[model samples]
Target: MAPRTYGGLAFIAEVYLGSPSIRQYLHVDTGSNLTWTQCFPSSHSFVDHIYPKYSPEDSNTYFDAECETTAKNSTPKFTYYASTGVCSYELTYGDGNLIRGRLAEEMITLQTRNGEFKVVYDVYFGCNDQAVGNQYIGTGILGLGTGKFSIVEKLGSKFSICFGLIMESKPTHNLILGDGANIQGHPTVINTTQGNYMIMLEFILVGAELKALDDPVQVHLDTGTTICHLSGFLFNFIV
Candidate 1:
């Protein structure tokens, strides 16, 4: 078997839905699962170009949330907008990107040690003119991490999560999960102030040196954020 590459994340794949198509990328997120993308009706949102737009008429997997028949084995809801009206299955990201759609089935491609694999899943995706311009950093988000409503809950199973960050200055950095790998050993077991949540980070290391912070920094496993963020103070100090 190929060496299992470890990344620090809750979900594994970078998957998203598009107009009449499905796109996949290496995604990083925390607590969300309404997979969608930017499309047809352009607007000033995140990077309103990477997301996909699905056409129900042409796509066999697409369905409308209003149709009662679409509710069979799926949840149908409407997304309300002050500017737009009620949208089916409205979705919002921590980064402020909003999507609207209903539950529909689609085939997804995933990478395995062997090769690419496929699975058909019922998902809520975005459609309409406003989402047309959502193309951004990653193709879309794979929402199967530890959360109240993660894809794993729907899938009803335990899954792995990992991510590799681009350490611009540092020559090496590693992200570990469950049982950590020893490449970045002696990781400080940082305490999370949050009572009980999967987002509590165990450590913040600087090339094997765990930097101690005065306050127990709140670190959450956010799936929606495309890149890791640090406050201005932390960023300056880290660099």
Candidate 2:
């Protein structure tokens, strides 16, 4: 995990997509599913591309994700229309930016720790053409969220993230996926609610005192977001 903050976002990893493999830098986000990259011939209102756009015509690995009988389970992050018979998607970000595109599968290449590249085929992603936002400087998002098409879910592997000391000038953080993931300490059951990683946070420890909350709060764990949101009632009670 090469975690450097830019545009108030943390962690951008170098990734390659397609058959021949075009290089791209993706923002590592766990808060949302539906991995997407900007494509060429976008709408006029689409976000300006600082990096080159992803062209499906250039990749032999590209395959369109077809229709499901029902629009409901078609895709967790996509909006389905029977007339098209193709998986099209629309995603909204926290900052009110919405992106629209078609869903497709392609080969993805990742750099290993030894600096060797590993190619994983048939990875689902959105080849987005329209978006509304200032557009953070990057290719797109590498979603680690719990949704069906997310990189983690598609790989069907357990992943782990290790954080370094806060005061360290150059923190040595690590993100391990599949067999290399190490999560052997204490274990807590994780529950998924609408692609959110939910865990019951029953108590809070301040100094030597352990204080129990009146009501157990369900916390969502997300590496994508840097801030936490609480209900007004919960905020007042905690304060």
Candidate 3:
């Protein structure tokens, strides 16, 4: 993973998938739960084919995740395939962008910058074949949200992600999973809002001046989301 692209703060990770392990660059998103990547020969797509797509047929470790439930009830964010027994999903972002894919399980390999290896087997993820927005910088997204199918849950109960200076000569990484992560700092509870990470904002201070925000606002911490959004009243009050 590295720095954000252009005006956005996007850090992509080097993740290997399947038996032989095909390399893929995935943008890290703490706001999402499902780790998804673009797949080859897409039946439908609007974004230009800029990056190479992942072929599931090539991966011997890939397996389709069947729908456990009997009924196929289509929702605004998810869909089920009863005929194929495949669990498919559709996610609508804040910007109204949709990412549609099929759920599957595959072996994953995480290689650190220091040549370290951490392999996790049977990790659930989405094989995206269709999209509606610009794919941006990576082949797909690496969801790090605190969800059932997230990388954080796959690792351990507690984890810490460190973002150091973006100097290539001085590469630094201290990603700790489990009890090894130091929990000494003044910690605040993180709430899950709309399947994403959220926190209550009390007030805004600019150069020691406290800004007025009548009520506490729910602020989402999304690494994948590049833009900052503020309510009209909050925006005017702050300025």
Worst ten in a row by lDDT for model 2:
67-76
User: lDDT at 42 for candidate 2?
Assistant: 70
| Tens digits of per-residue lDDT for model 3, 21-84 | 8787777778777788887768765434444457899888899876563124322245567887
Alpha-carbon shift of residue 100 in model 2 (angstroms): 0.4
The TM-score of candidate 2 is 0.81
lDDT of 2 by residue, 52-169 (tens): 4568888889988864522465334465678876777877777677788888889999877677877888888888877777744466778888756788866655677776653466
Per-residue lDDT tens digits for candidate 1, residues 1-239, read: 00123233223344434334555443444344444444333443443233344344655555443343233323224443445333456555545655544334454444343445445456444443343334234434545454323445444434443334532232122222222223334434433232112344435788978876665566655554546877786776666
RMSD of 2: 3.3
Candidate 3 Cα RMSD (Å): 3.7
lDDT of 3: 0.72
Runs of candidate 1 with Cα error greater than 4 angstroms are 1-26, 39-54, 66-87, 132-135, 145-149, 164-197, 201-218, 226-239
Per-model TM values vs. the true structure: 0.51, 0.81, 0.81
lDDT of 1: 0.43
| Count of clashing pairs, candidate 3 | 1
The worst-scoring run of ten residues by lDDT in candidate 1 lies at 1-10
Ranking by TM-score: 2, 3, 1
